[model samples]
Target chain A: MLAMSASDESARSPGVLIVDDDAGIRENIADLLSTEDYRVYSAADADEALHVLEAEDIDLLVTDFQMPGRNGVELIEAARKANHLVPAILMTAYLYVYEQLDADRRKDITLLRKPFDADEILREIAARLGDGNAPKR
Target chain B: MTIPPAAGPKAPPSAGADSKPPGNRRTLFGATILIWAVTAGLGILFSVFAVAIGLQAATFDVMRWLLALAIEAPLAAGIIALIWYSRNMHSATAAGEAGAQALAHSEAKYRELIASAPDGIFVLDPQAKVIDVNGAGEELFGLSRAEIVGHSFMEFVPPERLESARSYLADRLKGLRATELYEATFAAADLKPLHVQLRSQVVRPSDAEPYVVYIVRDVTAQREALRNLVETERWASMGRLASFVAHEINTPLTNISLLTASISRRVSDPEIQERLKKIAAQGRIAANITGELLKFARPGAISPIETELTDLIRAAVEQTDAFRKPGVELRDETGTRSVVCTVDPMRIQEVFVNLLKNAYEATPRGRVRIRLQDLGSLVAVSISDTGSGIPPEIQSRLFEAFFTTKKKGEGTGLGLAISRNFVASHGGDITLTSEPGKGSTFTVVLPKQAPGVRATE
Candidate 1:
């Protein structure tokens, strides 16, 4: 299932995709991003996330590494295959999995180990999406 | 002479019918009586002859009769003496036969006792060659009596232990050792090492050379049991500590980080925001540590399933491949053969990944090798690295929680401790063999059947 939150100025705001198997985390991130004046799209698993990716124009991808069908890495790879050069953040409780990523794959991806707060996630998002002030085309 | 009967009523009842004189004594008495009668008859005949001659015969006839009677008496006494000598010889032969039967019976009883004893018994000649072995010895050595006898006892001892074994034997033989107990490793017929306790003594027979008798008890299982107990206790205490940290400290740390973030977002002052951020950052660090602790604490969540061991190991090797340095070579020696076991795949996979990652991290410019072996009742996976091996002092504490040789941010030190707990929950164990300057090998052995499941033949 998809949960979309668009502000009145969402047509000009950057769109962000949040994919996680956890409903609480996905909705919380969506709420945070929406309040920061970005349009938010959320999915509970890789399959739902894939549907949103095909249907929406997302400026950034924030995904969890461990999920039901495909992991965050595979989802990111799928997005890249579809010519979406959107920057991505991979959050995981398993740090070893992040260390196993090749240098090339790791270069474009930011890692957030679990139990992270809103500030860290917001900081990483701002770093990728340019302070969340101007909307990306 | 006449044979005298034994006094019937005066004889001890314990002697019973045997108290009577034997037939040989009666025959000797009869012979004596006949010989004396003949001697008397002959004397009478001689006297009559003298009287018939009628010339001053009275005195001379009497003297001649007396001489003849003396000669007859000596012959009769000699016959009796011969019969008595033969009777004594017969009795002595009967007694010797009874003694031989008793000795044979006693030897058979001792042989049975030795054969049935649970501990291995070895009778070694002074040269240390096995002259005799009991049934238990045969089972312990995994060899038959024919295969063991005449072989040097030293042959079963491992090469490194031969000196100590020889020393012990020599001391016992020379009576220099005050105690009869010693312990050592012995290689069985299959070349498997056995930990054994030996109680031995030297036996010197008057008619034969001195020999050593060893009573060997296999203590391999007992030693393993003791090591397992110590290991289990260590992990259990570590787990308790992890549980305490996760339960008591984790919730507060999380609240501190979340509340600080919430407050920082609302506050407009830059100074307050910066300080709150710092507090949040420290909370995150503490939370990270607690997160690892939770993983170590919660091993009972294992969901065991039938999984192929080689495939699991392969996945781990692949996962850790990215950690390999430029000049480090990773070798997968796990063959294509499928070795299936009941295990929690996620937990076991984590164990493999942890070990492999450590190997790759340690070997910056050498080789990292992983191999799988199917040991009938169990399976072993070994991860070896050609890196600077762990030192003796650090090796003992390698599996301790929060004990790390790595620089601060590189490790939390819970990887090995958690991995060991995971493997142990599966009724398996992890062992390390390392040489200071050479390298290290970590072996994880898992039972084919899960801990609570009954094993099938």
Candidate 2:
């Protein structure tokens, strides 16, 4: 699943995992991605999100920073420990918390401030995935 | 020697023994002289009779003469001793009278000192009764000296503070504590509460009983100022918390906004699209409010560069000229000289723009004037408008966040507050002067070089 050929990439839809404690935000983001020809999985928290990561081959992980029990940063760390080196996007309303992360760790993750335009997040996802069939206008 | 005559009735009371009546001295002198004369006369007569009766020879006998001489000498010595004793008694009386006069003078001096003191000085007897109170003490209690004296000090203390005040006095009198400073609330003549600071000590006079002396000062104003300071600090912290809450709400607002836009793009029905547009606009309004709150809460960083202040002010005036109402005129009075200074250009420009816009908005048909000046170590920009000025009560709260005189949907009330924060971050300040019927002027002053920024010139 990690090494798909050009022909397979065009045939199979890219999978995205959306995690947030807020059901409204999580479902809205899932609805947007599904409309863009992407297969989306949703979770309410880090534990549920990790289970989905283990069960399905997710191409991208999008999560919120502040949550119940585990935060977005820790989930990203746990995913790497599970040998899932998927590209990640960390969404936060708190700029100070994002700034507090280790520089090297932050370099690998794309940060999206909340209340951002839909076009902004889509642009970041497409750039990170780097596929010709990525979501377009 | 005879005793001297007494001084007359008009003589000073401190005249010592000399102040006695003249009639008494004359009587005493007369009696002394009479006793000596009578004794001498009797002796002579007795001697003559003895001779006549021939008890002895008519010629003098040496032994008899010697006995007569011895008797006369003793009488003379006794009279001299009486005069000496009277003189010494008079001297002692004089010294005692002088000492009493000196004591009276000293007591009068101390009375004057206490009367003139600024702090309320109270002299209390052992029973805590007010034996004496100064002029200031009278003024403090709003009562005359007659009303304040002869009253228990506890009578002036409010019920809530009476017990504590009693304990403090008791501790001082009993030597149980050495703390002389205390604070208490006292009731004035009209029962108004007075916050006072008292310094009291036990005064032990050798010639009198031990008593308490208190130096009291009114501290109500100081306490009120301190309370206001604490309240201001509390509001400042609340502002920070409010900004944090605004940040948290932004995420959901983003979801609402983006989701609505997404749906609007996919829908083909004109009616649904129009409704969706309204919802998006409302969401944007909420977003704008939170954005302004964040700006006032955290001003972030400033980038300083060497720039001419005259140019900066001109640009701000031009940007805000659009806000001028019909018939209102704007004039730029800045001269040609370049007043170069190290400052955050964007932040400082915003400050000027905010002031200029406020000036233009205030003057409906009057003139707005903007001027720039270069002081040696500082620079100033003044914006004046010929408009109905702010009332004094509202002027104090003008810079407060969310405080506005503008109508609903016309202002967010964060413009001046954020502008002040920006200027303060650059080590500057804004000042205002206004007259009710005349006009208002706002002045922004900044140092030649921003704090922590190296001089570029």
- Binned by DockQ into CAPRI classes (incorrect, acceptable, medium, high), candidate 1 is incorrect
Superposed on the true interface residues, model 2 gives a C-alpha RMSD in angstroms of 2.8
**Candidate 1 residue-wise lDDT, B246-266, digit = tens:** 655643554465567657656
Estimate TM-scores for all models.
Answer: 0.50, 0.55
Off by over 4 Å in 2: A1-21, A33-135, B1-228, B298-350, B365-371, B437-439, B452-457
lDDT of 1 at B410: 76
Clashing pairs in 1: none
When summed lDDT is taken over every stretch of 10 residues in candidate 2 chain B, the lowest stretch is B1-10
Candidate 1 local Cα displacement, residue B160, angstroms: 5.5
**On residues A9-122, what C-alpha lDDT tens digit does candidate 1 reach at each position?**
566677788888766677667655654667788888878877888898788899988888999999988888888888899976555566567788886788976667777777
Query: What i-RMS does each candidate reach, in Å?
Result: 6.3, 2.8
What tens-digit string does per-residue lDDT give for candidate 2 at B1-457? 0101011122222333433434445655666667666766666665566556445555556546744754674477457746854675566556656755764565466567767878898877778988778899999999898887899988888988888889888888898877566888889887877889999867654445667778899887898899999976875786788678787788789788769867976899999999998888788788777766766765566667898998899889889879999898887889898899888887789889888888887888889998888888888889999998999999999998889899887678988988887777778889999998788999999888889743111
* Residue-level error in angstroms, candidate 2, position B395: 1.3
